[model samples]
Target: MYGSQPARTGRTTLLAVLLAPALALAGALVLLAAPAHAANAPRTSVNPVIFVHGQEGSAQQWQSQAKRFSSNGYRDDQLYVHEYDTSVATDDHAIAGLEALVDTVRARTGAAQVDILAHSRGTRVAHAYLAVPERAAEVAKYVNLDGRTAAAPPGGVPTLAIWSSLQPNGSIGGAVNVHEPQAGHTESATSAESFGHIYAFLRGRAPLTTRVLPELPTSVEIAGRALYFPQNTGLAGRLEVWRLDPATGARAGLLPQHVVRVGADGAFGPLAVNGRGHYELALVRSGERTNHFYFEPFERSDRFVRLLVSPPGGVADSIDACPGHTALTVVRAREWRADTEGDDRLRIGGSDVLNAAVSPRLRQILGLFVFDKGCDAVSHLDAALPPFDRIPFLTATDLHLPADAQARGTIPVTQTMRGTGGIEETIAVPNWPSDRHTVSLLFKDYADIPSGG
Candidate 1:
């Protein structure tokens, strides 16, 4: 013992850091005035938000999030939630549940389009309905809450994916599924902790984006927790909040206050929004919607595979546009382009915006990543483009990686992801590629820190 009392403690700490969950601080809450134009907004809107739970979840999973909306002024007539199996043919289950929900929302809202907020298997379900000729007419907006179904997302609907961007280190029991590409399984709607952001999106408000991108800390330390969650239950709006704890992975009440920010983490990228603050979101791949922007720790001793949590704030579009080893490129966002295009043009983020460009070297990598986070991927950006070379995708194929191995797990989204219900998951095109040169896009995020003003 005389050799060292503190020395032994240091060894344990190192072991824990390597085997613990990573935590990042989220954005602070602030109040702001509603835009003046919001008052004159149209009445008959698209599909009302329909929350779909994952795995063994019940309708109660959405209770907390639904309450957040009600408290924030979202009408009850515009809110809905669904529960599906974590076991069985995920595709079949999604198709049946989604079709019914579409009919209900349409009849209830008396509107043709319905916005969708689907989680886990629900993502598959939502797209399945969109594939149905009778149902596509109902969805105007779709926000995939980390639902990883089939492969890619279908076209036509705008999407937003708040993904964790990290991999899971756990196993389905005790077997490690690392490199499986489908390892870190999480749902956008898994926790009651996401209520704040959920409500913000419903009414079209801006989510906080980090002013500074945080670098990974030198070491990580996760202490004080084990894991235990309810095995099976069916309540939708409130289970994740009232029953399960993301930190310890227990079934105890996870009070909203327990949600805290800790440790340095990855860069929370910016989002695009208009005067009303409704920004478009999409996933880099289709079914990958299962990746939550934040993954909470299931076991305090587990590192690398933290549980999925909501974004610390704002839009976290998983966009990596690099052409080759010579250069890295990011798709330029027209978010800040002057509206001389007209007031009708999509408004840029608030007054202060940054200007970043794509390196000419990376010009050949031009196809768009079907946003698992927003409206029809190609169509959304295409609508804004003047037209050029059009390359349709397989919804299940990746355009960037040709080797197939390096592109493992992540699927390339095409016009038709799969056949049946999968078609809805695949996006459709209204026009073909033109022979003209591809139009240039504006990029904002730069991994390389800006040198000066």
Candidate 2:
């Protein structure tokens, strides 16, 4: 219905049609009144974004994503498409591309650094800049988009390595990339809703800590190993946290109580990240009634001990929890809910289909991606169920994540294993490029409350 009008026709309708492009572009940027050609601010200008495509791809690999960002607000000048021989080791021309591109972007924009978003082997090319040493300062942020390289060339420059799910080999942290989804990854950028996390993570924001609901201390842990309360069980203790809504300013969401086991051996957490990106308890106390909530981040043994004596609120505040606290890991949207013949399906990016007006049953806001596949690729005829041909999501089995996902994506995928706490391991991964990867985890104390209500 919205067709372009011929110019100089002098028709009022023609003028309206011609003005559309200018208006649409203006809307993409937050400001409507800002002049279209106004020069961006110096030093604070948005650094150029160099996109490194994935395997089985081309610059066309980013065609859908590129158009999406442009429609949202990103200008063409800010996007640089770096193509390489996917067959080669990726160092030869890729390194040369990075060196030349960084200098060009910095010189042209007068910005101190440039940002990079690379997929799969593309990430390898982007990181190689660190080896040059001179160009390292020219690059501000490097988003290893699903590329699983954990080796960090010693540099103080902060890096946010994005991954799809928890993969053992993918971590630059001193320890293995933490598997706790409730606590976001400290070393790698892991989240289920990759798109929604792009903005803040690109800006260098750490995981946002949640306010455990207002409640009195009902239970206490005697030592780092045991719980003393309504029931003295073999299990150590459990955690109960209320979810705070940043928008409504209320406890709109909540996570089930997570328990930790105390064996004669030692302390560990078998927590996991679920498809929705929430922390799932893998183990619960052998036997117990309801109890208050307390959570201590997995920092050092001292923090675990401090949690035992630590006054509820401020006690665990500064401690670095396993996986960083972020909604990106927890945000989810229900897709293909009405499917009759196929299995349930969901979109794994930060795009939360659950919270949309389409479904009231969806009560959570998890993620938002700047560039999303609106499914323009899938024919409107093929996506729809039958008479109503609306674009639909893929089946459960088809939801795969981008590369490097398992290495980083699982921090928010914790709700799967219900238990106390220990170390949840990835058992089996059935999906890829997924909101939640098919994996197993080992938690100490945890439980599963009926969700999707």
Q: Report clashes for each candidate as comma-separated counts.
A: 85, 91
Worst 10 residues of 1 by lDDT: 1-10
What lDDT does candidate 2 reach at residue 129? 61
Error of 2 at 208 (Å): 16
Cα lDDT over the full model 1: 0.30
TM-score of each: 0.33, 0.35
Q: Which residue segments of model 1 deviate by more than 4 Å?
A: 1-46, 149-153, 165-203, 207-453
Candidate 2 structure quality by residue, lDDT tens digits, 1-453? 000111111101000113356657765212111112113422335666666655422343343333233323344455555654444543677678667766766665566877776666666776666656677777776666556565563233455555543343455543122232322221122122343355455544421211111111211111122222111112344433333222221233444434344452223332221212212222233343222222222111110211111122421122222211111111122111222223222233322222223211121111211111232222111221211122121111111233243233222122222122323222111122222221222221112222110
Per-residue alpha-carbon lDDT of model 1 for 235-260, expressed as tens digits?
A: 11111111222222122432421232
Off by over 4 Å in 2: 1-43, 63-73, 151-156, 165-169, 174-192, 204-453
lDDT of 2 at 93: 70
> Alpha-carbon error at 411 in model 1, in Å?
49
Measured by C-alpha RMSD in angstroms, how accurate is candidate 1?
Answer: 23.1
